[model samples]
Target: MNGNESAPRDAAPRVVVGVDGSPSSGAALRWAVQQAGLIGGAVDAVSAWEPPVAYGWNAPVVDTSLDEENARRLFTDELREVLGEECPVQVHPRLVLGNPAAVLLDAAVGAELLVVGSRGRGGFARALLGSVSQQCALHATCPVVIVRAE
Candidate 1:
């Protein structure tokens, strides 16, 4: 290769995957890794969280700093569990605080693809009920892929 020529991977596509530390999300993460490898691309592991209600039913507001840290831990653990310590393609872990659908759509702005789990509800039927994957499929600028756990 000539020095003037750039590497193919330098312009590789970016695949964004939503990970919520669930079994379905683990499957989605695996799928993202494989897809990224196939296209010589990278994966953006995006995890979103809110104030939590702050959890249970109408519970009191908890410390947000701790919540953020816990979210990061979950994100890291999920990645490690799914892709292990070493992954074939580059995997960027992103933790954001917002609606899952909004977070994913924002991340997918310039991405080559956006991936999310079926959340046990498959197809357009889930859209009627308003799932994150459906919101992504309908609004993402790039292609959206909904993966289901094995």
Candidate 2:
């Protein structure tokens, strides 16, 4: 299917949201949860992380497997904390390794909507869309929503 194509009308749609433990991402997660409740669907909170690469005459001497694991645990725990037990909908937390934009776009396949925060650590202007948000908006298989922190 094309990137902009919506899901089939008869299917039970899923909502995917990117969360990074930031305030903005937290807002996005909350928004996505509400939207899922309204639509009678479940929410998938995705967190993506990639190890830093060292550039030099080195043979990739850096190991980030443990770091990635810790980050995944932390992100999942934070998401669960933010989405308290009183939340009205089901939330599934996922942690993956890759570029954030690519990961979200891939997850958007067969989803009803892709949600992300407006601004992130990247050097994007706060007044406008951040890089990851813009990328997902442009490339997601379904409609994309950008939630900005209040």
Candidate 3:
């Protein structure tokens, strides 16, 4: 190794995973970590939230701070539960505000891969793919992996 030629600082790849505090999302988080381990990459766990549309113009004003805090806590708890104490890969939690699919897609703009889970609606065709997962699969800049609950 020549002194003039420095090692690539950004050689390690990045994988983004969407977590929505659902069982399937937990599985997806695990899957993303496993894949990151294999590829020598890091994982970014992203969760999104937005103001409820049902709040009418004349309706009582609601504070979104509480909701954001709860979303952050949920995201942290899910990450901790999924990764446990001996996690091998580096995982970063990202909380954003907006549509889930759009947020995930934006987060994964330059990622090596993006992972998400099916919402797992039972006894129906919608069980196959959730809207977010479907949109990500169709529009993500990088490869998208969809994990389904066993």
Candidate 4:
């Protein structure tokens, strides 16, 4: 370690947070951003969506673009609600069409951490952890942090 020598540059820890436009997710997003600032890392805000399909003996065809567009809007709104126009640390917004848990798990690969809320828009109202959060906690490659809604 001399004046002319330089230390190796290490990548900062990256955190992946699930955002579903829910109050709990809003809190999670805020928490993730704060954690990222503390760790000198970045935040990946992921939002997942599924096409709408009417349930019946025979379902009618629905326009998937509408669903995707809405997903994108919701993702943007959620990020804005928490991070405002500018985020303190780097924030990567990811909008994917698939199962929420699966999408989150995939995005968390090689990431330093995965963060999710204890509850979201769906699932039983009394469950300690929502399905997506539970799945991510159990299956995410990196350590999972469940942030409860305030």
Candidate 5:
């Protein structure tokens, strides 16, 4: 090691982005990838899905294991297809069974940035931001970037 050649001070940071198969999320993914290139960081694509619930007059039941697995597969496939093989940075796919906001917030705990879509499949049409995006922006430990839908 030569004293004249100092170690590179700029280290790659970890970036986490949440996806839900929506066009808005696709934009977020693209944005994250670009940011990763600028910072020489890796991107982790995360998705959260819960099982459908059956509501009855007598009882309500929910089983999410299968749904979670399906979600994982979907997210993985999408990442591979959308990101393609030419991307320079590393990409990781993650899927969990829970509320989207909660899962994203948890993953953001140690990340340098958390990226999300501006809107999702929510009922409210006039809201500026989707519930998940708003929640993450408010509660995430890292910086939150919301990519608006085209």
Candidate 6:
């Protein structure tokens, strides 16, 4: 198969999709699932969360585990809502603490395709493309698919 193709039929492909618990991200997850099914591949649903930045020299410590738990829940709930039980394609949920683009790029290693929403739940929803999506498109090792909310 060509390098540009999403996956080859002989091998089990992995499609990594970014999830942010947003409508557009939901659409991207659904699209990734469909693509995985078509290619006989698996879906990796990923979400990234980070603690709020502190400016003082002696900054107050925040409970980052809560953010991690929320990220995990977001990934799982999004997958369940999109595919429900007995999904045709296998879905793997992953939550990490880092920038969205960096997390997605790391997840895309050896992945056949990387999928993400054009814009996430961020303030710039009206923008054509979110920073994460744009960065992944430019730097991902594999082909990237930006799913737009309809």
Q: What are the TM-scores, per candidate, against the unseen true structure?
A: 0.80, 0.85, 0.84, 0.87, 0.84, 0.85
* Tens-place lDDT digits, model 3, residues 1-150: 221122244757888999988788999999999999999998888888875555677885667888888888878887889889789998877888888898888888778999999873223564578888989999998999999875
Clashes per candidate, residues 3 or more apart or on different chains: 1, 0, 0, 0, 0, 0
Q: Which stretches of candidate 1 lie over 4 Å from their true place?
A: 1-11, 54-62, 120-130
Stretches of candidate 6 above 4 Å error? 1-11, 54-57
Give the candidate number with the greatest lDDT.
4
Give candidate 3 misplaced runs (Cα > 4 Å): 1-11, 57-62, 120-126
Worst lDDT window (10 residues) for model 2? 1-10
Candidate 5 residue lDDT tens string, 1-150: 121121243645878899998888988998999998898888877888878999988888877777777877888777877788788788777776788999888877667899999997664888888999999988988899999977
Error of 3 at 126 (Å): 4.3
lDDT of 4 by residue, 70-108 (tens): 889878877887889878999878888888998888888
All candidates' lDDT scores?
Answer: 0.80, 0.82, 0.82, 0.85, 0.81, 0.84
Error of 3 at 101 (Å): 0.2
Top TM-score model? 4
lDDT digits (tens) for residues 1-150 of candidate 1: 221222254567889999997667889999999999999898888888876555556667667798899889878887888888789999878888888888888888777889898782333543533388778889999998888778
TM-score between model 1 and native: 0.80
lDDT score, candidate 1, position 53: 50
Q: Compared with the true structure, what per-residue lDDT tens digits does model 6 show for residues 1-150?
A: 222233445658999999998888989998999999999889888888887755667876677877777767767777788778988888877777888899899888888899999888885646788888999999999999999887
